[model samples]
Target: MDDEILIVDDEHETACHVREGWKVLIVDDEPEVHRITKMTLAQFIFDARPIEFLHAYTGDEAIAIMANESDIALILLDVVMETDNAGLNVVKHVRDVLQNPHVRIVLRTGQPGQAPEDDVVANYDINDYKDKTELTSQKLRTLIRASLRSYRDIRTLEHHRRGLEKVIAASKGIFEKQALKQFAEGTLEQLSALLALEESSLYTLRHNAYELRNSTLETLLSNTVLLVGDDKANPSDVVLEAMRQRQNLYRDNELVIFCNNPRHSLIFHIEGTRPLSQMDTYLLNLFTENIIIALENIRLNELLADNQREIIYRIGEIVETRSKESGLHVKRVALYCELFAKLLGLSDEKAELLKRASPLHDIGKIGIPDAVLHKPGKLDADEWEIMKTHAQIGYDMLSGSDIELFQVASQIALNHHEKWDGSGYPQGLRERNIPLEGRITALVDVFDALGSDRCYKRAWPLDKILTLIREEKGRHFDPDLVDLMLANLEHFLAIRDTYRDEFQGE
Candidate 1:
């Protein structure tokens, strides 16, 4: 398996990542067995590296070792140590309890009568079984090599699966325009890691090659990075030359990759001391191809998200306006939700999603009659009941959409009204049953709502608002979140101040 590495391109680092010795665990009770096994394999090497040895004397000890050691390639086990079927139980623990199916287990027994070879092989998921007497030096060596090869292949596939999963998780949010620069930076770091290369950069310039109509290209042309030596730069020359020749460049210690979409072209210049191998070249080609596609997707998705955001604000404003509220209330609420998410340590993608989706939290309020919504006095019991239905109404309007934003928005609209305690309306879900996004919106929305002017109630003073929040901890608000709000109260207040309603000063 290629060790999880960034696409870096230096010989020394590449060698270092893959050169570590394979780990082997020796499990037996006898001191001589451990001594002889180590001596036998003292000079043995595979794939240009020696073996790392670990010893465990009992089934309990082996199980302990297996618990802590994830990368052990092989276990040479003795069947009748401590108990008659101790090795069998160790195998069960390794395979069943630990759920580690990758390590190769070889069962060696001193007494053939204690564990019949056929029975041991059939019952246990062991790769090999042999009577201790039958293992000559050559035979033992052969078994070790075969087992190690199988372990290597299995681990390689497992590592690749994990690598792909991690890539997907990280890149799933890459289409967000704000993430384009971040994605490029990560790719450069990963590329450096994958090839063991050093620090590098990716720059994108768009142009119609034949005409060179864009005026900005002139300044960009001068300061472009050079691949080798004195660091003058060539984001322009390399791209233009490669475009002119219509091929990627392959010179000694330098590589110029040229890729283009119909609208524009992308070129990269990298300097490496090691010459490119066919595998290295292939990986680079695949990476660049995917990166070009990602850059294009970000462009398209950014446009779509911007439009969605505008519609959301407009929708939120229409609802608020009918209730005699400022449109900037929605804006303030959005910013507050984002700030709360940030303080909670939500990922940038999740926090950004929350910011975008939060404006629609009250979209269901659009369905409420204006008389109840805009009433200048406290709501009657019947009117309060009617007002409470907006949560479910908003959810109904937004739920069942395949779009990710709408799905998140739907949950927020539905659950934000549900309080930290069971006293909340609609479904009466209490505590953590409420989704985190809902909890976040509920807190920030209340913070904004209490601090802002409403036709029914004047905006409360800062001290009064905080007093209520502090009193509501574990009642109306999540205790931890309330604590977080208190801890970063200044920043939250700053966000509110920044996006405060225009009428607030009056």
Candidate 2:
């Protein structure tokens, strides 16, 4: 079965990029200073990008603009404004208060005495200090270029820092997911985040593990490998070549990453606007290493769950065999419990738990004396009392285990015989007092048991069995469960037909 990519967002999100142009904020009280600075950089285009100018007359205004805009690349500030030390204070706001270490601040003052150049430079975190007299067009352009270049380098470092953080966080998150598909989808999503991807990029999984049908991801998180770039170029040949070679392949706008293990072979097809840079490659590799390990962990969990299911059924069969009942009884009961649980609107997780635990409802019968257990006739009052002790015995045997499966089994074991009206059971837990797991198991077990041949009695006709169940509603059985069972009788019958017991007589 293909898994749906419900945890995955269909939209492709790109990494952060530089805005329209490098932002240059001019913080000076003199209107002429702003004009001259703008004129000085009117023909300026650094690294083939233009400057976007922002002006603030007062230190307060500079702080306000800085507070609103986190991506202002450079600030050309004046030392004195509303307050004599306003520009210095703006530097404080940008550094200590805003904690914005990336934006480059160059202090330019008309009266350097208000805040001396050497003193201000040493005490404050300004990149450069320029007196008003040093206003040559060439010098100013060179200054602007130097500041913007520094800003770009810092932004790159910040981007990488954020990227690494995402990888670390994503690794932790994927490990916590027990389901294979969820983990895979999460991996694909994280992969998409590593590059500036196109909206056309698709994520799919190999080995049919994840099937992302532009809609659902089958395996590998989805059977979808994200193919990025111009949609016209088919990377099928490249993908096949990588698979054969068992090596990672990178083309102009495509990436074929091959990961092979003894259990499975997965090829990740990633596409982007341009060829992957060394940094992008490094991040993806790191992400892949974490994902492969998480995949192994999920596989182990799956194997363990399979083994547990086998052990439970085998144990239940052993107990049933002692009472001369067919093993199919446990299977039917498990399926019925799952069905009933689902119909009751229990989640998939809860429904699955009930199914796995219901088989052991009669596990306590293992401790019962064989003479009463396998008897060909009904037991007398004393013998019946001895037979009834199996419920508590089963609960006691399973309750001590720390495992969740057994914990639930203990509940089912203890309360499966409890009647709705407190008329039956070891503890006579009445009505809703019985755990829902116990109640669901009780209804389904009796329903299957009555329809099947027991050692002491022949299988009753369907009509008789259902009549007894309907009559006992609100008494022996939960009225609501009984109603649901009757309503979905055909589905129940289908389940019975699917797991047929050969001992069921004509």
Candidate 3:
């Protein structure tokens, strides 16, 4: 018989022992019967594992052992121990009370007439009923071997069932992940659960092809380690060689899986002491195939979102350029809005939304006539009134779109000009009545407009802009926001300097 099972890869091999031992519990009142059973099976080995014997002298003792020990694969239960139906009661407890249907139970009775084979087989959940006198050494060994095989098969099926459920749950989790790092971490978590290992592993991505070529195997592994927790182990020589050759490596205590994509490659290193069965290998392969698909989908979604954001920035630039303002005006304002939103305790998602939507704050100016938009001087009262209508026009153009980005853009376009004191805009909305998105954009827009040179006005000095912002706090901007901007004045100045206009040279 093969002492080890090897999961093979092309030109590379990884092997694991089947497992250690089969735990067999012997329940009986007679010391002689326990002695005889142990002697009979002294040299017995099944499935490449020796037998470990657990003895219980009474039915209660057997129940206690069964309750405490989960790995007992077979029970040689004796009928009429301490009670007439003591062994039968132990079977009932194992099957019904403990709900442990996995352990195989065989009833051995010296008093065959008391518990007949036909009655015992029909009534009790015992695997086999044998008269103690007929159970010789060889017959007992044969019976134990058969019972162990059954136990092994049942445990394998149970493992696969649990593994499938984990795969299903993991698929849902991976699908919900939006970022690459989140997806990779989630994959590591789920893979650990699938293999019944502790969450002490690492995941890595290798992007540079040249690095893979120039670096030694150990150096490559060390450089690409992205997520590592408490449980860390060095990759074995077999594992490193498998990775170098781009193949899966599975050993008794560790597994390394590789996923290749056109843009990059991912490696997952998992460690545990349990040997994986053939079925485990199959299930792991299936789970990894699904994970690769999910990872690719998340990558594609990220690319799509980047494209959409770029298109929005370009559209905002066109509107700004039409009004004779530099496209950099919107870029600076967007960064300012993002920083302000974050300092105000907005979540990462909301801050990103604000960054993407702030550029469209002046999108309404696209609808204004060129004469008013490019006036080169302060707008006359009548012309200013017409230009103000652009806010409502931009809102109408963006509203009613199903896209979430456009919906937020619409709110910023309409309400960014509204005042905290209800004195400004097409809507004259007062303090808190205005959406928070509009409020943030409003402050950032004014800050950028004051510091930037535009068609109508020269850029103000930093000190003059700060004084005006402080003076108009409650009248033009949210009091809290004005305080926050002043507190983090350097951050806004940094953004202004980074995306400065062509005339604002380094």
Among all candidates shown, the one with the greatest TM-score? 3
Give me the runs in candidate 2 sitting further than 4 Å from their true place. 1-19, 81-83, 185-282, 453-459, 504-506
Best by lDDT: 3
RMSD (Å) per prediction: 14.2, 10.6, 7.2
Candidate 1 lDDT, tens digit per residue, 1-506?
Answer: 11211122222112323356779999999877787777767656776667899999999999999999988999999999999989999999999999999999999888889999888888899999977777666667778889998997886676555445444543444433346446545544444444432112223222111212222454546543332223433344555666567557655545666655543344555655665544445556655666667767765667778899999999999888887777888898888888888887888888889999999999999899888887878999999999999999999999989988999999999999888887887788899998998888888888888888765567889999899999999998899999998998898888777876645432
Using all chains and alpha carbons, the TM-scores for the candidates as numbered come to: 0.54, 0.81, 0.84
Q: Between candidates 1 and 2, name the one with more favorable lDDT.
A: 2
| Alpha-carbon lDDT of model 1 | 0.75
lDDT of 3 at 39: 67
Order of candidates by lDDT, top first?
Answer: 3, 2, 1
In candidate 3, position 159 carries an lDDT of 77
lDDT of each: 0.75, 0.78, 0.79
Instruction: Give the Å shift of residue 214 in candidate 2.
Output: 20
Show the colliding residue pairs in model 3. Answer: none
**Is candidate 2 or 3 superior in lDDT?**
3
Q: How far is candidate 1 from the true structure (C-alpha RMSD, Å)?
A: 14.2
